[model samples]
Target: MPSKADADAAPPLPEPLRVPVADSHTHLDMQSGTVEEGLAKAASVGVTTVVQVGCDIRGSRWAAETAAAYEGVWATVALHPNEAPRIVHGDPDGWSRQGARQGGGDAALDDALAEIDRLAALPQVRGVGETGLDYFRTGPEGKEAQEKSFRAHIEMAKRHGKALVIHDRDAHNDVLRILKEEGAPERTVFHCYSGDAEMARICAENGYFMSFAGNVTFKNAQPLRDALAVAPLELVLVETDAPYLTPAPYRGRPNAPYLIPLTLRAMAEVKGVSEDVLATAVSANTARAFGY
Candidate 1:
C-alpha cells in the first residue's frame, strides 16, 4: 500500500493526447481529490470520459451516484474478489472496510450482492464488475466464495445487458474457465488485462475487450506489451485504474485519469500505430463495451 505522502504527491501531467479517449476503469472514491477536480484535470489532458469502478456496496453506491451527477462518468458495480471472502468470513484486517455496509456470513453476503444487483439496473451503472478471482490475496479457504460471487456477478451483467468487467490476479485459468462455463456477457472486459500473448489471442477469439493500464509501461511488462502487440485495435481499451498502477517514470506515485495519455502513448507504440489512430479505436471501443 502507498503511504499518505505518496498518495498526496500528484505527478506532473504529460502532454495531452491529440485524440480524446476514456479511462475505462478508475476509483475516484479512493483518490485524493474531489471528483470534480479529477474530471477537470483529465478533460484538460484529452481524457474526456472515465468509468468509476466500485469494489463493494458502499463504493458501488458512490460510483452510481457520482456517475448520475456527472455526464463524463459511468459506473461499474461489484464486490471485489477479496471483499467476497471478507464478507463471508470477516475483515480482521479491515482493508476494505471503509464506508462498507456492516455484517458477515452467507446472509450478509447475499444482501450485499442484492444491492449490487439493484445498482446494476441503474441508468448510470453501465457494467457489473471488478469481480472475479484473486488467488494472490485470498487463500484456498476463500476460493469457493470468490467463484460464487463471480458467477453471480456474471449473471447480473448478462441479465442487465451490461458489460462485465473482470479483475483476475494469478487466477487466469479459473477466470477464463468460469467465463466459458457461465457464458460471458456480450460485452466482457479484462480490466487492467494481465494476460500474455496467448491469452490475448484467446480473448480476441472470444470477442472480449482487453483494457490496458499504466502497468503496461513498466520495465518488466514486456509480456503485457507483447499482448498489446497482438491485440486487435477494436478489442483494446485503455484505463488509469487511478490511485494505483502509476505509469513508468512515475511508478510508486499516485495515478489519475490525467495520466492516461502516458499509458495510451506506450500502448500505441507497442501496437506500432499512431497515438491518434489507437486513441480513436479505444474511444469507440469503450463506448461499445460500456454502452456509453
Candidate 2:
C-alpha cells in the first residue's frame, strides 16, 4: 500500500497570480477560499464571468453547482488528464461505457459521456473542456494515456455541440496535429495559449481564439506577447487561469478573476487598443465560444 507521502507533487506556481479580469478557466470549487468569498472579490474587481470547469465527474458536478449558484459564473465538464487514471484501471462497470483501460475508479471518465448529456441540459453549463494534451510533463506512458482520454473528450464536445476548451502544455505539435485530424470546434479557444507567433498565425487561420494568461506580461514571454500582436482582435481573449498563472505586479499571491483587468491592460498595450475595447472584445469572444 502507498503512504500519504507517496502522493504526487503539486503543480508549479505560474508566477504573479494577480488577475484584473475574467478568469476564463478556473476551478473555484478547488480553491482554499469559500466559493462565495472568491466570487465576491471577483465582483468587486469587475470580473464579468467565470468558467468553472471540472477535472472529473465529481468536480464536474461541483462546476455545475458553482455555475448555478453564482450570477456571473458559468460551467464546463470534461475529464482532465491527471484524473484520467480511473477509466482503465479501476472497476470497469463504474463508467457507463467500456473498452477503455484504466488502472483504477471510474470517477473522472466513467460518467463523462453520460454527464456530457446530463450537464448539457443544465442552464449554466457553458463549454466542454479544460481538456487537451500535457506532453511536457507526462512521459510516453502518461502521454499515451492522456491522448486516449483526449480523443474521447473531443468526441463528447461534438456530440453536445459545445465549444471546446483546450489545454496545451509543451505538446503544441501533437495537439495541433490531433486537432487537425479530429478537427477542433468551429468556435474553439486555446485556453492559456503558450504557443509562439507562428503558431498564433496558424490558430488565427484556423479560427481558434488564443486566450493569454498573466504570463504574457513577464519579460520571458516576448514571444507570446509578439504572438498577441499578430493575432487578430476578434480571436484574442484574456484569463488568469487563477490559483495558477498569476501575472506580475502581484505575482506571488493566490489568484482570483478580479485581477484579470491587469492582464487586459497589458494586452491592450500590446495590441494598441483601449482597455474598454479589449474588455468588451474578450467578453464577447468568451460568450461566442461558450454560447452564454
Candidate 3:
C-alpha cells in the first residue's frame, strides 16, 4: 500500500484534450513563400504563434519581416555555428556590421552580433538565438574562438534582456559550462531539447525552458518521455524547428509551425495533462520568453 502522501502527490487524471498552442522555436524564415499558407495551416491546427529563427543576416532580416507580415509570428536572431565559416569566408559585403573589421581582433563572430543588434532594435524581433555550442555535429575548431563567439551572444542577450534559444548538441557539458560562466540570462531556452533526464533536472534547477520538437514523439524517445516527468509544465515549451522534426503522423512531410499541434498532443499525453492546459502554458511561456 502507498503512503497517503505518495497517493496524494499523484495528480488526478488529466482533463480531456482541448485548446490551441504556439510553436516556440520555429524557422518561419526557412519556410519562405509559405508564410500565409503556413499561418492558415497553423490556425487550422490550433497553433497560435510561430517564433521564427534567424540563421544568418538574410534569415535575420526575413525573421523580422515575417513577424510583421504575419499576425501570430515572432522572431529570434543569431548565426548558427554550422554557418560560422560563411560569416568568415563568404561575401565580404554580407557582413552587416559597420566598418567591416575582419578576423581575429573583432573576429568574424562580430558579423553575427551586428545582425543581432540590428534586428533586436526592431519591434518585431523578440529573442536572441538559435545560438550556443554545436560541437556534436560540427568539426573541430579552436575552443577559444568558439567560446568567444558563444559568450558574446550570451552577453548580448543579458544586455538586451532577451531570452536565448540555445542549440546544445553533443556538447552538453560545454554548453552547460558556458551558460553558467556567462551567467545566462534569467530566461534561457534549450531548443530541440535532446538531453536526457539529468539535463532536465539541471534545466529545472536553473529555471531554463525546454522546447521539445517532434523528436520527442519518436518511438525510441523513452528517455525524453521520462525526462518530461521531471520538468514542471511552466518550464516546458513546444516547437517544430520546422522543415525538420515533423512529428509522427506528419513525419516526412516538410514540417512547418502548422504541424505543431501533433507535437503538442503528444507532449500533453506525456505529461498526463490536458491539451488546453499544456497549450496555454506553451503559448504564455513562449510569448513571455520571446516578448511577443
Candidate 4:
C-alpha cells in the first residue's frame, strides 16, 4: 500500500511496448514498491528485464541478493562518485543527509570497495559501476577519492569480465581520460549518458554503449536529444533510471520500469525510426552490453 503522496507521485502506466526490451540501468532498491511488485509491473508493459544498480556497500549487497532471487533482474555494484568521497573522508554528513548508513575513513573506503569487488564476481552481477567522476555533487576536495574509486571499479569490471557502467556527470573529459588511461573494459556503458553529439560520436568510436534515460524527453534536454540523434542505433540503450528522471508529461511523477515505453517512444521519434525498430535494437544492444 502506498501513502497518498506516493500514490500521487506515481504516474499512470504508459501504453505497453510492442517489442520487449531491457532497462539498461535502474535502482529497484531506491523505488517505493517491493521488488516483486516492481518487476511484475515492468513485465506487464514489456520491460522484461532490468539491471539493479547499487550505490554503496549495503545497496550493493541488496542488489546482488535481489538479482540472485529474481529471474529477470541483473545487478551492477559500485560506490557512487559522491559516495566515494564520503567513505574516503569518513564524512557522515553526506550519508546522513541522504538518510543512508554512515561509513568510516580511508580504511573503510578500501574495505567497502573490496566488498564491491567481491560482489562484482557474483553470477548475477553483470556490471561494475554507476561509478565515475561527478563534479556536480562533490567539490574539488573529493576529486582524488572519486578518481581512485573509479579506477578501481574499472579494474574490477575488467577482472571479472563484466560490463563497466559509468555515471559521468559534469566530468566528461576527466571520465574519458581516466577510461583511456586505465583501459576501459571491453563492454563499457555510460549509464544515464549525459553528453553531447560529439561525446556520443566518441563513445561510438570506442564501441561504448550510450544508455539514454527518461530525462532525454525533457523540454530543456535538446542537447541530450542531439546526442541521441547522432548515437548509432547499434550502440543505443534505454533505461528509466527509475525513481528519478521520469519522462515528460510526467516529469514530476515517480518513475518505474513500467513507464519505459514513454521514454523509448520519445527516443524513436527523435531518432526518426519506428518504435519496433528502436526496441529491437535497444533490446539486442542491452543484452550484449550487459552480457545477458
> How much does candidate 3 score in TM-score?
0.86
TM-score of each: 0.95, 0.84, 0.86, 0.94
Q: For model 3, name the residue pairs that clash.
A: none
Clashes of each: 0, 20, 0, 0
> Which residue runs of candidate 2 sit more than 4 Å off their true CA positions?
1-21, 85-113
RMSD of 1: 2.6
**Candidates arranged by TM-score, highest first:** 1, 4, 3, 2
Using lDDT as the yardstick, the better of models 2 and 4 is 4
CA RMSD per model (angstroms): 2.6, 6.6, 9.6, 3.2
Question: Model 1, poorest ten-residue lDDT window?
Answer: 92-101
For residues 96-148, write the lDDT of model 3, one tens digit per residue.
34233454234656756676777876777778888887776666754445566
Ordering by lDDT: 1, 4, 3, 2
What value does the lDDT take at residue 209 in candidate 2? 84
- Please say which candidate is ahead in TM-score: 2 or 4: 4
Q: Tens-digit lDDT track for model 4 on 93-203?
A: 654443334556666777778889999999999999889999998899999889999999999999999999999999999999999999999999999999999999999
Q: 3 or 4, which is superior by lDDT?
A: 4
Candidate 3, run of 10 with poorest lDDT: 8-17
Evaluate all candidate structures by whole-model CA lDDT and list the values in order: 0.93, 0.75, 0.76, 0.91
